[model samples]
Target: MFLPTTIEEVKKLGWKELDVILVTGDAYVDHPSFGVALIGHYLVSKGFKVGIIAQPDWKSEKDITRLGRPKLFFGISAGNVDSMVSNYTASMKKRKIDEYSSGGIAGKRPDRAVIVYSNLVRRFFPDVPIVIGGLESSLRRFVHYDWWSDRIRKSILVDAKADLLVYGMGEKTVLEIAQILSRTRDIEKCKTIRGVVWWSSKKPIDCHELPSFDEICLDKTKYAESTRLQTILTDPFKNIVLCQRQDSRYIIQNPPQLPLEQEEIDNLYLLPFERKTHPFYEKIGYVPALDMIQFSITCVRGCFGSCSFCALTQHQTTHVVSRSVDSILEEVRILTKHPDFHGIITDVGGPTANMYGSSCFVRETKGQCEKFCLHPKSCVNAKTNHERYLELLDKVRTINGIKHVFVSSGIRHDLVLNDPHGDLFIKKLIDFTPGQLKLAPEHSHPKVLALMRKPSVELFLEFKEKFEKYAKNSGKQRYVVGYFIVAHPGEGKRENEHLRKFIEEKLNYHPQQIQIFTPSPGTVSTAMYYSEIDPFTKEKVFVERSLKLRNAAKANLMSLNSAR
Candidate 1:
């Protein structure tokens, strides 16, 4: 059942007032892939009346006040993707299509949707506690660089004027907040919850202090230092509390929420999700994002790859968590029963598909390792086994009504190459994948690859050769699609030319998946983009800051096939 979006629907449920209302920047889809729905359903399961207002018209009070405000708090999210990224392109051009919106139309959500939505709610309710979360809020919880404005902005908690901010996967954090507000009705008592950030007049004792907003604004070096500190302290095992001054007030961030246990994550995915767009969007048109993921299943959570440009490490963290095989198979059975079921499961993995059931024994016992598990070199303590994931795939293919099961999520080739059972896993993956097996090599130049924290191009070449041989042996015409990024930190005209030559000679194909890098908030790449200094190495790096040059590099790569 869909959560009530209007007062009439709320009254039909015999509820006088809802305990929580979630506002999102995307159209309402009651699917687990949608953040607002997953959170709303979880809150409902905890015996609280929950409602949602999606993509509310920010200019007026109509949609914001339709549900009449909640008793506990208002939850705000900028949808699955950050709002600014959703609204604009890497070149700062306005985007024409929003997959999360009705009919793939753009302009439904404002630029900074989190801040806009929170302000709208405050204008109407005036007294309701506001809690902001999701990808946009999570990455912006600290004073970080904003590519759109090309300046350092204070923590989102300050700009949004929100009462509290929840970071990371927020299921447990939000639940705790709801329960506390229900019993005590005091927002002050919810400050110490893990995975939450709140503002205080004075800094808390024993907390790690980051550079003040003013200092970072004036000194780019200080900004880079702050990014370095935040990255190391991200380990939940460290239990580090971070504080930064934002003008007169201080923003205190508690330690991240610990990774969910196996049983906990297992039950979270099994929550009652209709897995379809709400009837409210029927007249508007189909939501493009829902169509892409309705039949797909998320078999894992979190990633350990820690790519410099990727935000998974900041939001999902480096802890790798996978759902039980039984839970995944059960969900597949349920998907087969859906009215839209077509015997095909589009995807069955998380941030990195092959990392499912993989873990680091050293970190599991001691804590986060000083080095990344898969970068530079595979750590000795890291477990690179793919046997359990292979077993799960074999069992899934035998289920009735399941015609095809594909791993559409990003696959870390380096991890597969290091795994003992990589050969068997690759053979099985090739069979499950449809026409193309997608992999992100990012770039070909060693210097650029190093800055991006991706493995060398040699690893990709090794994997591609094996993939082609296996596909030929199996009589399938499968292809390996390589994804690359242009104009990342340390990439110049020389680096771009190197990438073009490698694609033409080594890859031997026209690249279809190429992107101009966008310096989003709370990433090492973004810190480098803003400061022109590597946060880890503390050395100066070349940055392509011209928008025209960034676009030209992508155009040059895309035009390679025609030129050939």
Candidate 2:
């Protein structure tokens, strides 16, 4: 059921007051894919009267107060994507549309939506506890660089003046916090919870102290060192409390919550969601974001691929947690019964489609592995297989109401190339996937790819050859599409030239999703972009900071196939 968005809905639920009120930048879409919906629905199932205020007007208290102040606290999220990334393009220009917003209109949310909403909530209800989470807060939980402002910023908890910040996938943290606050009604007491960050008058004992906010802003080397330390401390078990001083108080981030077990994640996905935007938003028109995922499925959480530019690892952790096949099949069955059912399932994958059932056995036995599973090279301890996922796809296809099931989320080509039964897997994918398969071979230049923590281009080329051969043998004329990033930390005009040449000469295709790198917070690539040095080796790396140079790099790729 959709959480109460208006006083009328709240009344209909027979609630005179709510225990929690969630404020988000996106329209209220009661789908599992949306954090607000999942969190809201989960809270409701737990017997808390939860209300959601979606895309509230930031200019005043009118919209925020619509659902009335919560008895426990206000949960503020900047929707699915970070506000800056959602509102502005990589070029720092205002975006024309917000997929998460109703009618696909932009500017529904402010630039720093979390901070804005938190501050707004504080203004009206100064005493109420305000907790911030979601992509914007999780990524910037510590002192990090802000791309839009082109400068170092204090931890989001400090800037937003929020009482507590829930980092990572926040289900466990939020539930714990809500439970604690319900009994104690003390925000300060919620500090010890894993996956929660808060400001402290004094630093906690035996914590990892990062460089002070002022020091990181002034010293690039210190910034790099801090970034390296932060990444190392993301392990749920080994991670100690991380404290960074912002002036007088210290921002204390507790260790991340352990990755949800399979049953736990499945339960979260299985929550009773309406799977559509709240009817209140129907007047504005259907949300564009829901159109894509309404029929899609999320089979996994977390990622093994530790791409430097991606935030999946930092937020969801490098460890993978997958749902059971029966649970996934149940969701598919429900989707097929929907009135808008088209007999087509958009996707069935997670961080990386093929990494579905694969996990590091060492993590299960010991604890969080310090190094990533598939960065410098694929870890031998990491269980790399596609059989379970392939079997799941076959089961989904055989369901009574299902027709075409595409793995539209894309696969890790390297995983497919390395699998012992990869030949059969590729043939299955050729039959299951749509006309074109999506893959991200960010750059061809070895140094560039190395900085991004991606496999070498040769691996991708080998996979392409094998996939094409398999497709041809199967009488399929399918093609592979690639996602590349320009002006990434190490990529200069020279690297871009090499990338262009490789695509034309070797791959014999022009890339379509070529994007200029946007330095998002809490990412290794963003740290490198800010420090102009590789975090691993502390070696000076070429960084293209000039807007014209960045645009030129993108234009170079854009020119390809224009005249073809």
The candidate maximizing TM-score is 1
Pairs of residues clashing in candidate 1: none
The lDDT per prediction is 0.91, 0.87
List, residue by residue over 341-390, the lDDT tens digit for candidate 1: 99998998888877788777766656577677777977777676588887
Clashing pairs counted in every model: 0, 0
- Model 1 misses residue 145 by how many Å? 1.0
Clashing pairs in 2: none
Off by over 4 Å in 2: none
Query: Model 2, range 1-564, lDDT digits (tens) per residue?
Result: 778888999999888999999999999998998999999888887878899999988888899989887989999999999999999888778899999989999889998899999999999999999999999999999888888888888988888988899988999889988999999999878988999988878888889899998898779878888888888777786767888988898988888898888888888888888888888877889999888788888998877687889998788777788899999999998888787888999889877888898877677655556676777787788787688999999999999999899888867787777778988898888877688887888999999999999999998888888788888887889887788999998887789999989888887667688899999899999989999999988899999888888988988987887945
